[model samples]
Target: MTGYSALNMQQKQAIAQYLQSLPSLVELDRDDGVGLKRALGNYWGQFLPEEIDSV
Candidate 1:
């Protein structure tokens, strides 16, 4: 995992919440999820599957 691990739990929680809430803000297709993952990686870093599972 990238900077995600470095972030405090609250920050991770915020990102998780934002990602979770995206479905309410806009229609989410598979590509949207992929794109979001990429964006998060670019902005933060890679995420381990277990780390993502926590989010």
Candidate 2:
């Protein structure tokens, strides 16, 4: 398996938290698809709370 799959739950959670802490597109001036995709991929399986994601 690739190194990504080897990440432990805690590591995943940390990544998620880091992602969640990032500024939104408007705030960061990163409204492009590539920027958004990069942000999402950086956190992979991590999901934000519904309220936040819905915004």
TM-score of 2: 0.46
Deviating ranges (above 4 Å) for candidate 1 = 34-55
In model 2, where do residues sit more than 4 Å from their true spots?
24-27, 32-55
Q: Per-residue CA lDDT of candidate 1, range 1-55, in tens?
A: 6755678866766776676567679888999878877766675333322344554
User: Candidate 1: worst 10 consecutive residues by lDDT?
Assistant: 44-53
lDDT of candidate 1 at residue 30, scale 0 to 100 = 95
lDDT of 2 at 4: 68
Over the full model, what C-alpha lDDT does candidate 2 score relative to the true structure? Answer: 0.61
lDDT of 2 by residue, 1-55 (tens): 7886888777766776665565552455546546656767765535543355564
Q: Give me candidate 1's TM-score against the actual structure.
A: 0.47
RMSD of each predicted structure: 7.2, 5.5
Question: How far is 13's C-alpha from truth in model 2 (Å)?
Answer: 0.3
In order, how many clashes per candidate? 0, 0
